[model samples]
Target: MTAAQMTSTSAGDGAEVAAKGTTEKRRLEGSLGVPSIVFMVIAAAAPITVIGGNSPIAIGNGPGSGAPLGFLIAGLVMILFSVGFVTMTPYVKEAGAFFSYVATASGARMGVGTAFTALVTYYGIQIGCYGYVGWAIGDLVTAFGGPDIPWPVYSFAAIAAVAVIGYHNIDVSSKFLAVALVCEIGIVCILDVAVFINGGPEGISWHSFDVSHVTDSGFGIAILYALTGFIGFESTAVYRDEAKNPSRTIPLATYAAVLIIGVFYTISTWALVTGAGASKARSVALETVSGNANMMIDMAGQYAGVVVRDIMQVLLVTSIFACVLSFHNIISRYQFTLANKGVLPAALGVAHPKHDAPSRSSILTTVLGALLLLILVVAGLDPLGGVFGYCAAIATCGMMILMLVSSVSVFVFFRRHHEIVGNPVTTTIVPLLASLGLAACLVFILVNFTMVTGGSMAVSVILALIPFLAFAGGFVTAAASPRMRGRFMANVL
Candidate 1:
């Protein structure tokens, strides 16, 4: 080739590389420090919502006394998994959390598969919250002697609000989440103290943690309930690319999220059991099974007074809103990553020049969630019982399986790249241990999904297998198309 022609080609290649490098670099604001990242992940966990919604079942339905142990075990497994997860962070600067990690360890085909699963799961969970949040808003109004609007109306309104929040700089959402998170935890602590002062129904006892109680009738289900509380904790890694000082920020945020949420679950659940009285916990929980979702509200009135109960009820709604918003942001970021990497339509990868957020991806996520909400409304399903219970369970189940895959993949990645150096615990053993814990949880969820959903076995089976199908489908699609595999390898793998 002529020198002039070669010179032009070289210039084009350099500019292309520079533009590629600048894509993620200039799109996200690096302002989300550790504390902000923590709020996002913890909010997604929705501590107040979990305690109010799941604790009664955990205490009464599952291993009665042994339920708290499930949190400890789940937390430990996550902490162990994080050791290897963050260890690999330095190698993958802007790659999507599980998307990149799974790709790097497995292959581009599998990575695309994992990305699809993560995307579907995050999207489903947010939609599930939308169903519940509308019902929550309706209740909030009627309880205050205000008019009760239809839930679908409230659901659409909430989707708009969340889309707006998610379309801005992430720091904006972080600050908002921090406030909601503090209120959620604060009220729980207040009620916890009051329960202690009032001495509970039968007074405090160690019966909540008794091994015999955990191994009782519904042992598998109790552990399932407790472990699901940590569903959003792994989202810490989701913000790695956008986090300030990502290497330091991610590990700290992840460890902190798991530890804080873990302690909160263990202590608050025990207090709840005591508040209801250990011996009477099962009976009280069963009584509430008909209605009265928030036993904390009941406990708040019993110990603190009526005023606290009302406030707690209001915060419960906000707690779920915060959770919905948090997941909205997560889904957008993941979709943006997929799009930019060629795993999805490129339109989703567009970032707002001014806001530095994935504007298009956020809007798409909002629209998709709204569409799901519409389907629920049109089907005339019960918002809380049918939509939230069924969709959320499937989402949570998908995430658990992904975590299981990630734990095992961490070991594979480190083992394959022997040149990659890290402590043995972080590189090898911890990943293996995490894999086992997550696998056990996945097994229980799959086997007992029908029982968990309180629905038809066929529907439960379909929901439970969504993650596996997404993962396998991604791999097969990629394997079938050389072009797709080439792009995944070039961009992400």
Candidate 2:
């Protein structure tokens, strides 16, 4: 609860230059406080996107009325994960987040491997989001009697928009995300309240929280989907360099993001179940998925009338845009940090002189996104079914790996630094427990990977290996270059 004082190491090259009274080396400029940080972090989660898109699939495939419990459980696990995660924030000061923390606690080589995996995590999720939002935009246009535009066209346009925003300073992106976050969350909250007040067809039953429902046969699948909705909550730590009081701000923002995501998803999902009676929830969800209908839209029409439903439809697209924009900024910063360490091209390390933003890296991210979109399109893959489904599964698997490694790093780092005193429960026990929990989540995703991707087990196995392959890629890059290996060691260890 005391403010985390910035140590020399934690302050990074930016502070070093500032202390030396030189403007020769430009760094990212920012003064973001907790609220702004939370806005960006939660924006990545895309509240409306999850409730409208992921919720129906989860409800159909998983525990039916018990889907709400899945989110609640996932939230609790992440909260435990954060206990140790935030403990390391005061120490690992770079924007690399997962990779930086693991590198500091573990080793430079392992950190590089983690860095590769982190890239896969962010890129996969962002690309998947692009596919989804593009498809959403196309659908919206066609609904209004306009000619049906190809999804990739819209996807590329969205990539351009994100690239433009990301090319500016973090402050610019944060403000844009704040507006989108409020509007999206506001609309969902209005629907949630409307559903609760009307008491739905089932008279506001709490059957969704029943123990029997939660422990049902499809609980694993339910948990996996629910956990996906919390994907970007960990990005809170990635904004460390730009934050006003990173030590305290990072922890507070992280906790707030997780709590907000957890509480919001749990309530909104339960409302979905309540809007349609518990018995009918699963069937309706299945219908929504199979028939390609929007359950939230239908529910809104029923509870809040047509105008609200139409507005929800539009906000859904904006929610996805915000999600991708947040990821674009995060990935750019990761590239910036890696470039600074010589893990990537030196050009990527330079921030824009005027904007003090990762302009070069942001451009790199945009180009990668366009290329990914082209690859998916050329493969003749369906945007939602193929791109979103496959990529999201890959991302979910990769993120779980990052979280698990990060938790272990926390434990290892504390054990090695015996002189650094802290609470055993927060610093030690919770991390180990979190690792176990996250490991289980990883296993669940692998075991039921087919359910998530909705593809053949052969494809599932291939997609699931991407994260590990990316990790191996990191190791190979480090070993192949002695200079880079030395650089990694000098910077992290």
Candidate 3:
């Protein structure tokens, strides 16, 4: 069979394909288990970055002390989404995550559309991280009395670093990410424990979860921002090609990623609220956020002393690096999957002969990200507000849409394939609920997009439309080109 025709059937088939003497068609190397997979997925979430970088805005502009409830709500929605998502993984034969699952249940046209959408989602987040990491490095340098360098210079440096790591086998990135994830989670936990021990000025309280606060006017925006922290969690399935015992690993990693991210965010946000006194949480958040500082970091400085605070400042930069590396791996694999299916250049489909990694695709992803960064520089946009803010808004919105579509696809796929024998609660009921929740998130994001992007109504509208445009572009390409149609129409499932 031709390389394009040999869709990925098993995560353990790498050696089989190699032994068959198909030197021209090496598959991605596999050996990753649950712990490794969990590390990568959680790193993509960048827990420290989310709490330190994103929590201020969420607290000030969202539900204030009630932000923890938003995390809880978003986590529950994701758990429901994962119920159907992981349940369908055993039947999918490819590592295209959203692309494979949607295609198997829906049609080639929609599958191709989803592939395009997934690309937009991952690339958006990756590029945004480049912007944030650039800003982060610049801040760290100045804090240490280093010369002032342009943020773009830092961004390029980070892109180069990620490119080097990503060109290696998945195992290398996984190990590095595991260490970074530990440090990121560690600092936050230290602060949490400190705040709990002190009991704050108001003496520890659950005021953040009060029904009145959760039902506040800003709760919708709180949920929107909270949901963004979970952006990369669903990516557990994207690494399936490199996973050992993927059917079990993917599900375990997915649940662990969701639960850890949810509980961590909830507790940390609550700690901040308690540390500041629930009544003063919003005011404290506004003071920090408005002055371009992180509320969590400030809280850490006050509760855990300058030592832990300094460590957090450094880890914040590393956290963004971890985010970039994790997303880089994901996008490269997606490109490899698309290439194997004939949607992209066939050259991108091949794994590295020595590393067994998607070297060609990784190079392309790096180039694309650099080009986007260059555009932001030439356009003279702010690394934090312009590049990070707008790009992150786009990524978060696009991911919500993908999750919604994936949820519906799960229900439809299971309903039609009675032979699969999935539990009704997980397959039908949970997915339907997940679809509604995600749809609400997408709508809320669109309606209040200016809040997320910190851009004008006009720019927010334009940025919001890009995901749909990408999906349409792919669907049209599949429908118009006879060659692409034939490739995309393959019944891999």
Candidate 4:
């Protein structure tokens, strides 16, 4: 061969190699079992936070003892939602969760839209959680005679801790969450059992599940609170690539986490009511100057005694840490996914050579977290009200919208790829049913958006508009990018 011809051939081979490298499949450490996934889900739910923060408001404002019924109702709805969600997981494989499923059915544009919605929703919620963590950790430190640092300072510290763990092996975060989960769950259970054994002034009765309270003025509010507690449950699918058995583990873990969160909240909150008396639960909750904020801590003293109460306080901080870590990992994975798909910077998708974790994305997440928390600190926003409350409200509403979209996508996906699935109910009928129920949920949440955010009508409208705008922005990006548009169109099953 001529020397010039040889040079051209060598260049052509190098280009093919580069192209193959670009398309290489990356895998995360798959040391996770069902238990690890469950811990991750429950940690994100932040059980102690809900029972302590939202439960009092639920019982005091809603139907008193009947508030536990809200959890049961929400759980049933989630189970129905899961019937379709889990059923479709086998056909697609990725940590993309709703974005992957949405794209599978609707098109790439909708997929990107879901991705943006999830990024906004999870990041918003994660930042909101750091607000609570800051206050809790700072208070705990001061109680122990530590320095009087600002809450946001403690928040930055917590973000730093998350960054440290998030950059390492996934198991490191998982094992820590498991330990945290056990401590928090154990303390809560002690309170639950003690309350059950001792009964209450009104008796440990079925009054909590009573049907008449269905028409109570705060019924919508109670359901809204119940739904918020399950915000991170769908994230079971996000750990698919890291699961020991994605098909079985993901589905079972999703179902178990939802039911466990629902039942756990239902019983714990009911115990609070029974410990205080049904008719008096609402009045007693409001009688406090703090109004339901420290109700659980107080109950731990009353039912489980002071030693347990102190332990509970300590565990509450750990619970918050576990949650922060869980979300840190989640958002990092999300960044990895978006980068892998060319939606974000490609460097965000690279795993650590030593840890096989999304180190780069995790680092980016940690930096973003620090920057966002700084904004809240500079703006002088209240950690509890402004950061935690408002962001959680908007994120919850956003998640519901994603769930509704996913439910419809399930049905559409099955219809389009009829050959891939067999059971009609699992694929189509149940998905359609879930879609209807989730639509109702979204409507109800929006109608009560002001109540959820504890803000004026204008503020509530803006909170409601955020998810829609984020989703639309993603759609426009996808439509405008011919490369992405073609990729989505060509990748259809």
Considering TM-score, which of the candidate structures 2 and 4 is the better prediction for this target? 2
Worst 10 residues of 1 by lDDT: 5-14
Which residue runs does candidate 4 get wrong by more than 4 Å? 1-25, 144-147, 287-293, 488-492
Q: Give the winner by TM-score: 1 or 3.
A: 3
Collision pairs in model 1: 65-208
Cα deviation of 460, candidate 4, in Å: 1.8
Q: Report clash pairs, candidate 3.
A: none
**Candidate 4 at residue 36, lDDT?**
91
The sequence of per-residue lDDT tens digits that candidate 1 reaches over residues 378-399 is 9888887788888888887888
lDDT of 3 at 29: 58
The residue-by-residue lDDT of candidate 2 on 41-129, one tens digit each, is: 99999999999878888899888888888888898999999999999887776777889899888877789999999999899999999
Provide TM-scores for the models: 0.93, 0.95, 0.95, 0.93
lDDT of 3 by residue, 160-227 (tens): 99999999999999999999999999999999999999999998868677778767878887788788
lDDT of 4 by residue, 263-368 (tens): 8998888888888888788876665315434778888898889999889888888888888898888889988877767688867767787888989999999998
Candidate 2 achieves a global lDDT of 0.87
TM-score of 4: 0.93
Cα lDDT computed for each candidate against the true fold: 0.78, 0.87, 0.86, 0.82
